[model samples]
Target chain A: MALPTYAGPLERTWYYAFRTICGLIFFFLIAPLVVIVPLSFNAVPFFTFTQEMLTLDPAGYSLKWYQDFFGNLNWHGAVKNSFIIAVFATLISTTLGTIGALGLSRAEMPMKTTVMAILISPMIVPLIISAAGMYFFYSKIGLAATHIGVIIAHAALGIPFVVITVTATLVGFDQSLIRAAYNLGASPTYTFFKIIVPLILPGVISGGLFAFITSFDEVVVVLFVGSYEQRTIPWQMFSGIREQISPTILAVATLLIAVSIMLLASLELIRRRGERLRGITPS
Target chain B: MAAATTSDGALTTADGIPLKASLARAERRNRNRALLLVTPLFAFILVFFLMPIFDMLTRSVDNTVVGSVLVRSVPVLSQWDDSSGELPSEAVFKAMVLDIQDGRETRTIGKVGTRMNYEKSGMTSLFRKSGRRAKQIKEAPYKEALIKLDKKWGDINTWRLLKRESDAQTLTHYLASIDMRFNDSGEVVRQPEEKQIYINLFIRTLKLSALITVLCLVLGYPISYLLATLPVRTSNLLMILVLLPFWTSLLVRTTAWIALLQKQGVINDFLVGVGLIGDDGRLAMIHNAIGTVVAMVHILLPFMVLPLYSVMKTIPPSYVRAARSMGATPWTAFWRVYVPNTVSGIGAGGILVFIIAIGYYITPALVGGVSGTLISNFIAQHISVTLNWGLAAALGSVLLALVLALYILYDKIVGIDNMKMG
Candidate 1:
């Protein structure tokens, strides 16, 4: 809103000042993210800007660190491991969580609130406790150090997100549509596949993406139950930071930052599309 | 005849089936379908999540090692009355020697020693040192033989501590987690001055987490208000600023902070270049509490903002305008009308931010140097480095309890079913 005419100086000052304060906060939010992009391209293996970089010299920027990150077999292995764990974990969490959401939205579900609290507890519990408990428990059950174990552990952690997103989509759903489709002589399975799946597809896919990201970003559990075979990107970065702040890490960080922006963009588009489909879009 | 016909009319379906039986079948089928849909995930989480948490809680109370190895001594020692303010009799010492020899032969003595030492300091060495020399003793004055091996054996308190901790189940790990220990005379007592570390760490964790929550509120509240008040076109563009960090890899953000806060990092270098400080006088920020607070506030600010923004969006601007039109000043109108409506939002955001901050692990571990560390770091140490799973489990249980308590509060104030993802 523009400044109003016939306002006192004090009122006008407060409006401008409020906007300025908000502007500073927005800058604070974005400054750190903006700061890291330039530093990742420094010619020297330094976190600070070199004189040459400040002067915009031709030799001031390099892709050597990016090369190092891509060329390292360990980094490649970590990327591969991350994909393997994240893919299986996303599939399990999305399927199971969608099913759970379906149950919870039903009118006849028993002890629905209590079961929901139980389902969401994994997200509420601290990572350390879950990791420690899983460490001991998995070892005893002969699940520790195996890919299947990490995948399952991550899937458990990711279920809450899936249930939350999918259940939200179900809230806007018209339950009558299911009955209407079934009344046309279509089977229950056919009605579900034809009606419900299409309506909830965006939520399902977005929820699956969230689950994938949760597993991708997870590190503490891997540290506890995983051996060398299960190191993901975050795990590698964690160890890399603890041992030495290699510039290659900065390059990888930059790359991950790009991935996050892409993910955020896709989620925003999915949300708008879902809202339109659910008949809530404003003109 | 009229009442019976009316009852028959009410109970029958249009298709001639009894309505009571048909409706009951439908309800049963719906319930079963719901259960069928939920069973796979319910059973999965039960095995992977709930069971492990239950297992960890039990570890806090599990006491099996000491009794298994010192089998003969525990019962005999229980019979001796150390309340007379003297060491147990010759019979107790003979039993102890026999138990140690039994433990040594089976090589379970070290395990027993380790378990006992967790209860009383230096007890493990006494056992270890005595086990080596117990083999040379071949006589009836075993009491003198043991006392000569270590003067600690002559103390009645040591024997009392031993007997009290020998129960097949105990609370030792939980006690240690809270920085309390059973004293020599067998009463729960505060740990001595130098040994009082865990309680202080717990307090520091709480304080730092609270500070981070407050910081997030201070920074996020105005931003959220702006996002809510602005036209949708501008606010939508500005929303990415909040979501960017929310979606960014946590490590990338943390690494950025490290690079910006280190002594040779961006902020320091900028300050030094601008003559704020000498090059040699670079400020220490990243590896301490300041680093932890700054980085965490940045990371968690979105959590506070998102909830507050959602709540504020629903509150109409007309309330403040009406209050203003009534001759109240803007500040007065805001304080009386606007802030009260946002209480639920504040509760939701504050609880969410605080709960997350309290259990934070990676940020503090990376940026928090010696004095900056939270309790999660120590929990990590015990789990991986120290190999004290029981103590780690106890620490974890306490942290989990804190989170769950706040979680219940959040649910009461803001329904857990309302928790959502962007």
Candidate 2:
């Protein structure tokens, strides 16, 4: 807000002080993430900045850590497993969650609150508890130490995001559009694909992205239920941090930060598009 | 088809059905369609998520280990009174010898010993030593033979332990989880001072989580207010500073903290370079409680800010202005008017952060070396390292109960539908 002309010196001083406090808080939120990028490129295999790097010598930075991450077979396997599990988990969670959100948004749905609570309980429960429970139960059913088991666990973890996001999108949806399509002689399936899907596509994509990230970043459950064969990137990073502190983890962290930036950008774009389509101006 | 007219002169459909019945049928069909769409995911969650949790809950009190291993002795021992100071009769010792022999043959005696060891410290070796000797006693007067083989066999408390643990269900694990145990007389008592860890751990977890939640709110409120009161274009650009970390991987942020907080890391180096501290006086920030609080406050700050911003955005700015125009001081207007209105956001964010921080595992494990580890770390240690599934499950159940209680409170206050992710 613009300062009023009648504002006193105290108000002016407090306003600037408030702004400065917020600026420092924002720096606290983002500085750690930004600091790792340049350190990831350090020529020495250390987490701290070197004298040469601080002096801006080109010799102080190198791509050796990136090379190590790419060339290592274990890292390769972890990357592959992460994508495969995340893709499958996202697909399952999105399909189920979208359909469930549709039902949840319906006026005629029974026991809506209880059903919603049950569907999203996966998100509410702590991950360690989930991991411990899955470890015990999956072992009994011969699902432990298998890729399929980790996939299913991750999918369950991802579903709540999909349901929440999709349900939110459906809140702004116009139901009359569906009736209009039906009255115009469109079949039920045709109405769904042509009218409903188009309107909620942004929500669905954003939800899918959420599900993907949840699965991709998940490590606790995989550690409990999966063997080395099912290790993911976070799992690798966890071990790397624990067993040996390496600059390669920094390189990987930088890449992951870049990925998150891209995802955040796309989610913003989709949000704007969804609002525009719904005829709601951005506030 | 014959038209059926209701006594109250209700309308009829063209198909000769009552109009209300037709409407009810349509409604029922819609309900079924909705339920049908939801059934698959519901069942999936039931099988995969809910069932496993229930299974773990059962493990907390599932005391079939001692009973199943000592099947013969349990039935025989049930006939004896444990309150009697005297040891069991020769027949009881006979049955014990047979049970231990069978258990040893099946290699299940160790499980029983491990379970019993949780109750009493020396039971594992006692069971092991007795198992090796029980097979050799092929004669009568088994009581003397067992006592000669191991003096622990003659102790009245040994028989009491057998009788108590023989039941198919026991609260021993639950009791042990809270740092209490059944003493020689079978009354629940607090564990010995040195052995009492879990209770302190539970308290520490709560205290640390509360501290983290308050820290997050303090750091988050000013930024959230600034973002909300700013023009939309500026706020949107500034929002990325919050959302970027929100969307970033938890491990990455934790790793970043490790890089920044470690003794030899960036923060310490900066301090040393600036001569704020001597080179030899670098702070032990990482691997301690300070590290956990700092890193977690950063990680959970966005959760606090996002909800606050959304709530603050809805509050009209004129309320504070109205208060100011009524001769209220600026601080009075802001605190008395604005802060009171944001209480719901505070509740939502406070409970959310506390709930999350209480159950945090990863960041704490990486940065919180010994003194800073929460209950979740102990639970993990039991599951993987100690192989104490029963204790792990009990600890987990306690944590789950806490989280669920807070969750119900959150659902009551904020409504779960309002829980928004980036």
DockQ of each: 0.81, 0.85
Residue pairs with clashing backbones, model 2: none
TM-score of each: 0.96, 0.98
Off by over 4 Å in 2: B1-9
**Native interface contact recovery, all models:** 0.81, 0.84
Best by DockQ: 2
lDDT for each residue of candidate 2 in A1-283, tens digit (9 for 90 to 100): 7788899999999888888898999999999999999999999988999999999999998999999999999999999999999999999999999998999999999999999999989998999999999999999999999989999999999999999999999998899999899889999999999999999999899999999999999999999999899999999999999998899999999999999999998999998898888788955
DockQ value for model 2: 0.85
Predicted structure with the largest TM-score when compared to the true one:
2
Model 2, residue B90: what's the lDDT?
A: 82
- Provide the lowest-lDDT 10-residue window in model 2 chain B: B1-10
